[model samples]
Every structure is written in structure tokens, then in C-alpha cells.
Target: MKKRLLILPLLVITVLLAGCIGDGTKNMEQQTELKGVLKLDGSTTVYPIAKTAAEEFMKLHPAVTIDVQQSSTGEGLVKFLAGETDISDATRAPKDNEYAEAQRKGMKLHMTVISNDAVGIIVHTSNPVSDLTTAQLKAIYFDGTITDWSQLTNGTKKGKINIYNTDPKISGTAELFNTKIAGSADKPYVAGTTIIHPTPKMIPTIKDDPDGLAYTPVNWINNEVKMVKVNGVAPTQKTILDTSYLLSRKMYMITDGAPKGLNREFISYILSGDGQSIVQKEGFIPVT
Candidate 1:
């Protein structure tokens, strides 16, 4: 991913201008021709955007092929470093150890920011708790200082808390939650916790478990679960963009080095019109 890549003028086809008034077949006639199979994996959170991009991109360049997989960020980076992937979608930057390993292997990694996202603190809809301070979030998720809902609700909702989180070992979202909110990842997690994988499942798990306290990507929030405020700020698009929400963070697409050839073109395409549109529709804040 290169700096200024997003703003780089795309090879805008006049057919796209014609699309405002043309039929589908007319737009197809003007598709840019590129040939290659792009392999993208990692960050199930980013899969929605990447998958949609791949589908739409292939439609334009019929000869180009793409395969996208929804694995955790760490898992994707593992394959990326091992030469198994063309790009790794991530919710957080590579860890220091990963950069060191890349240096040892003489691999130069490049990062391109794609969109904005936030870790959403959530609980079952039936729960009365609505807000959690950063201190309280850390206390509940990492320090074991707060375990029961009664501690936050003043005995009005008295129950032992059931905590849920994606495994920090494999999830960038979880790592972001622990490192950003909890302030560290080395500490031991408290007991009575259910560790999930892939982040999105935290939704249904918390939705069904009335006493659960959990965090997940904001995109996953639905009517089944209730999102909790961090400090006094709700995780809304405006709040994420202004970064008034403490948990907001950027989404990234990583490459082995400064991208070139089909890779560069594909990444550049994402930063442009159609790609950014997909990002916003997929529940991410467009970087553009």
C-alpha cells in the first residue's frame, strides 16, 4: 500500500460516466483489461469489503480472477509472510515481533489504510447496563476487578457476569480491544469467560446470554444485542470519523512490499470510487 495511492487518479473509463444514463451492457464494453489472480485473506471483519470489491472488480475485468477468504488477521498475516497470500486485510498494524521477523526474512511490508472501524462494547438487550468507562472496561475484561453486573448497576441488576471475547491470540479486533482499552495484553484474563473466534459470533452469544459483557466490531451490532457507550460517547459513524469514540481504529490492507503490477492496480482500485463505496456499505468509514 502506498501513500497517496487512494487519491491517485484511477484510469477512469468514459463508460463509467456513461453509466449514469446507460444500460448494463454498455458499461461492460468499456471495462479496463487486466489479467491476474489476486489472493486476499485475513480479517473476517474486512471480508465484506474485500469480497464485494473482488466480485465487482472481476465483473469489470473478466480475465482477472480473485479469491478472498475470511480468516483472522493474525492467521492471514501468517500466510502472507509465508508467501501464501497476495494481501492481508487487518484491523491493526503488524506487531513489533512480526516486523522484526519480516526484517529477518528481508521482507519489507507496506500498509495501506482502508477505512475506519471501532470495537463495540455490547451486552444482551435485556441487560440494564448502558455505559462503561475505559477504566471499567479494563477492570471487567482484564483486571478481574469488576465481575458482576451488580457492580456497575448498583444491585438493580444483580448477577454474576458472563464475559465473552474473541481470542486475543488470533484476533486483531480482540488485540485492539485489550491493548487499546485494557491498555495491555500481557495480563491474565479473569475467569468465567467464553473466548470466541472471528469476532462476529460474539453477537449471537451475547444476544442469547442476558448476563454477558462483550466487545466486537461495531458493524456486527444488530437489534439482537445492545451496544454500550464508552465513557460518554456512542460508536456512531460521526463519532468514529471525528474519533470522539475512544475505540475507533483504522482498517488496513497490507502487502509484502510496495505494491506493483496487478497488486498496485487492485489496491489503487480499492481506494478509488467503487472500492470506497463498498467500504461504506459494508459498515466501515471510508478513508476517502
Candidate 2:
């Protein structure tokens, strides 16, 4: 009878231990299953980096879904203000009005500098002019002060300049250009200039036109279009990282407040070494 009682106690203890182990295993599984949807929207210029990082992050956590959208930076800020997105990507810093709007909603906005990018002055490959000063760029795009290639090319070229610009109301690149070159976001582009939407369109638009000129992020510059030197310095990763390039700007990912849970993890991953590698591969200078 004593042996039977001792055996019953041993069985109960074993079952209790097994139950504890099972609970622990389930908890571990729950922790390992990183399941959530991450919504990202913002600058098409910053899209490549966000997309690449999203892709890599998903590989690490299969249950996580990231929906990345390409809209102009201004629109992204609008969505963020509406509490529709978890993250907003921007090629420039948030404007005062953006901060005010977020504050009006009682939401705390946090901006993370993810990368450094340069505003590239692009032209057709055949264009003989290889460089432009900040003054020349400002006059060309802002004041319409320089209207023809002959004015810049010293009579070597004779044609009306075809200036293109991203819509300042929507595009972060245009806002950056306006603020950096023209000294104000309220400043308008030169009259008669064509306004493009996404930054990528600027590449082919300039490539096909012999007299084409536009400003875009340096990553978008390809062999089809030649990127002109600004202030006697080319927009290289080194120059941009060192802040020696005249047209460089910091890229950002803004959250509503201090990132928590998966949002924190995702942003942490992006700032990590692996994520910065993707940044460099995507042709932007890593913040690190």
C-alpha cells in the first residue's frame, strides 16, 4: 500500500513537471512567432531602402507582413497625421506644420535619420556642361534667371533650357530642393517648367531630351543621365557622408512616438549593421 501511494505521488509530480515544460514550450513558440503587419508609406526616393529592409526583415520573421506604399512625402505625412500608417519615410526633415498637425492630434512624432542622400542635378549624357554652382542652379530652377544653355555653355550650345521639377506640394525632393537651393519651400519653381510626379520619371524624361535638366536623389542617377557636379563637388557617398556635398540631405523614418514592440524591433533592425548594408546596396549613405 505504501509503494502504491509513493508511485501515485511520483506520477503526479511527473505530470506536473510535464505540464510546466509544455507551457514553457508554448510560450517560446509564441515569442518566436513574430506575427504582425507593418505599414510603411512615404517618399518614393526612400522607397528602395524601406522595401529592401522590409524584404530582408520578412525573411527573418516570416509571420510579419510589411506593406510599403510609394507616395510623395507630403502625402505620407498626411496619412501619418491621420493615424493610418505605422511609419513615414522622408527624404527630408519634417516641416513645422507637420509637427503642429501631429501635436494637434495629441500624437508624439519621432524622426529617425536613416540615411544621407544628395540632390543630384541631372542632364542628358550628351550635354557638354558638366558642373553647376548653387547660384546657377538656383537661377535656373528658382528665378528663371538663366533660361538658355548658351548662357551657361558660353555660346557652345544655343537652345532654350528645358527644366523639369518634381511637384513641390507632394514631393520631398522638391521640398528639399526648394528649401536648400531656393531658401524657402514657399518659393515656386520657374514658370514654364514641367512638373513630374515620382522621382524615377525624372531620369528618363531627362535622358530622352537633349536639353533636359532636373534635380533628383543621387541614387536615381544612371548612365542614361549624367549627374552634374554641384559647387565643384560630385555627389558621391563619401562627400555626402562627410557633409561636404552642397546638396546633401538626411533621410528619415518618422514614428508617432517612441517605437515599441515590433515597431521598435523593425526600426532597430533597420539601424543595425545588416540593415545599413542594404542601405549602401540601395545607393544611399548609411547613417552609421
Cα-based TM-score, every candidate: 0.87, 0.92
Candidate 1 lowest-lDDT run of ten: 6-15
Which clashing pairs does model 2 show? none
> Residue-wise lDDT of candidate 1 within 103-134, one digit each (tens)?
88889989999899999999989898889899
What is the C-alpha local distance difference test score of candidate 1? 0.87
Backbone Cα, N, C clashes tallied per candidate: 0, 0
Candidate 1 wrongly placed segments (more than 4 Å): 1-32
Cα lDDT computed for each candidate against the true fold: 0.87, 0.89
True-structure Cα RMSD, model 1:
12.3
lDDT per residue for candidate 2 within 68-130, as digits (tens), equals 998989999899889889999987777888889888899888888888898899999989999
lDDT top scorer: 2
**Which residues of candidate 2, in runs, are more than 4 Å off?**
1-19
